[model samples]
Target: MMVGRDVQFAVDKKPCEVGKPILEVEDLVVPSKVHKNNAVRGVSFNVRAGEIVCVAGIDGNGQSELIYGITGLEKPTSGTIRLEGRDITNAPIRERSKAGMSHIPEDRHKHGLVLDYTLADNMVLQRYWQPEFQNHGFIKKNAVLQYAERLIKQYDVRSGQGPATIARSMSGGNQQKAIIAREVDKDPQLLVAVQPTRGLDVGAIEYIHKQIVAERDKGRAVLLVSLELDEVMNLSDRILVIYEGEIVGEFDPKKTTVEELGLYMAGAKKQGEAKA
Candidate 1:
C-alpha cells in the first residue's frame, strides 16, 4: 500500500542555454573587517547567461566576501568587475542594480529586507524610484500594492495580513520568498544569489530551486554561492571550489564527485589552472 495525492515532484528542470559572459570579476581582493589578512584574495571568474555557476566552499572561506565585492556591498581592494563588458568595479549598490544586477544576499535581515516596512513596500524597495512606483517624490501606493500582490501570488509568499503585513512578522521561508520575488521580478541579466535557499523547509527549498533554474532557463546569468554539497552538485552547471579566498579548482558538476570537491574546498588539492 502506498499513499498518492495530486502532486508532481519538483526535481526535473529544463536545461539552460548558456551564452556570453554577463559578469566578470578579475583579481578581486576584499579585506576582512575582522582579520588582518584579506578575505577574498585575487579571486576571478565570470558568470554567463543561462547557466548557474556555483562557488563552493566551506563557511568563512571568503564566499561572503566574494559576493560582497561583486555586488558592491564592500569595495574591492583591487581588480575590476564588469557587467556586460562595462567596468563597474567601484559602482554603488544602486548603480549596480540599475546595470542589470540583482542580489539575493546571504543575510536576509542585514541586507535583503527592511523588517519594519510593509510587505508591499519591501517588494519594491529596489525599484521605488522608478516612475511607475513614484511620481514627483510621492509613492504610488496603489500601484505598489498591486505589484506586491502580484508577486505574492506568483511566488507564493504567504502572510497573515497580505500585502499590509510587516516583513519581520512573516515566517522565515515566506520572507525569503518575498526577497526572491522582488529580485527576480527586476528582470536582471546577472543574478548574484548567495545562499538563496539557506534556511527553508524542504518544500520551500524545492520551490526556490525551481525558481532559480527557471531564471537560468530564461537566459539569466546566475552566480550562486552555496555551502550545501548536494545543492552544489545538483544545481550547478559548473563548480568552482574556493579555499582561503582563492579558487582552487573548477569542475563540471556532471563529472565531479563530492569527495573530490571536498578535498579542493578544504585546501588539500589545487588544480594547476582553474578556468573561469
Candidate 2:
C-alpha cells in the first residue's frame, strides 16, 4: 500500500498582476546542422514578469534549438533578444546570467551540473566570483559551505555526504533539486526552465512545481519549455505551440483544451499570426 502525501499539481497561490515583458525575442532564426536550414524560424515571444509562459511542442520540433538561441548556447542567424529592453542577441552566456537570467537547462548532466565537483563547489559555480564567495582571488570556503548547507536544508536535497558529496554520486532528483535551489536562490528576473521536471519521480516533480510557482509569485518571469502537456497546462499562464520551428498557435491555458493544443503542435492547425 502507498503511504505518502498526495501530489498536488496546482499551487493554491497566484502571482500578482503581470508586469511588462522582461524577455523579448523577435524573428529568432537559429541555423540548423545543415548550412541551408534554420532550426528556429522567426520565433517571437515575450515573457512578462509574474507569469509562466510555456513553449509546448512534441520533442525535436526545434524546441532544443529555440532554447539554445535564447540561453546563448547557440547564436541565432538573425533576430533580436532583449532583456529589460536591452539587446543581448549575441551576448556571452555569462553576460546573460549577469543580466538576471538563470537557466535550468534541459539536459541536467550536460549543461546543469559539474558531476565531479562537490555539491558545495557546484552550488557556487556561477556565483563564486562575487564578493560573498570570493575575496583576494581566493574562495571563501566557510561561507560557501554554510550557504550550501542552508540551501540543501531548505530545498530538501538529500545526499549521504551533505555538501561534500560529489554531484555524480547523488540521484537524479537530488541533482535536479540542487540545480533548482542554486538557480532560484539567485533571484533572477528571468528564469528559463527547460524540462525542469524531466525523469523525476512524482514527489520530486511536485516539489519542483511548487518551487517554480513560488518563483512566479515572487514576480519572476518564467519561460518554460516542456514536452509534457499536463505540465504545460498546469504551470503555464500562456502557451505557445511550436511546430516545424515556428510558433503555430498561442493559447491561454484557462481557455484552451489539450486537443486544440495538440492540433497546433502536430501541424494540423495554425493561427494566422501568433501574437507575443
Model 2, position 77, has a per-residue lDDT of: 91
For candidate 2, lDDT tens digit of each residue in 11-70?
A: 555745699899999999998875567889999999999999999999988999999999
Q: Count the backbone clashes (under 3 Å) in each candidate.
A: 0, 0
lDDT of 1 at 216: 93
lDDT of each: 0.92, 0.93
Q: How well does candidate 2 match the true structure in TM-score terms?
A: 0.95
| TM-score for each candidate, following the candidate numbering | 0.95, 0.95
Instruction: List all candidate RMSDs to the true structure.
Output: 3.0, 2.5
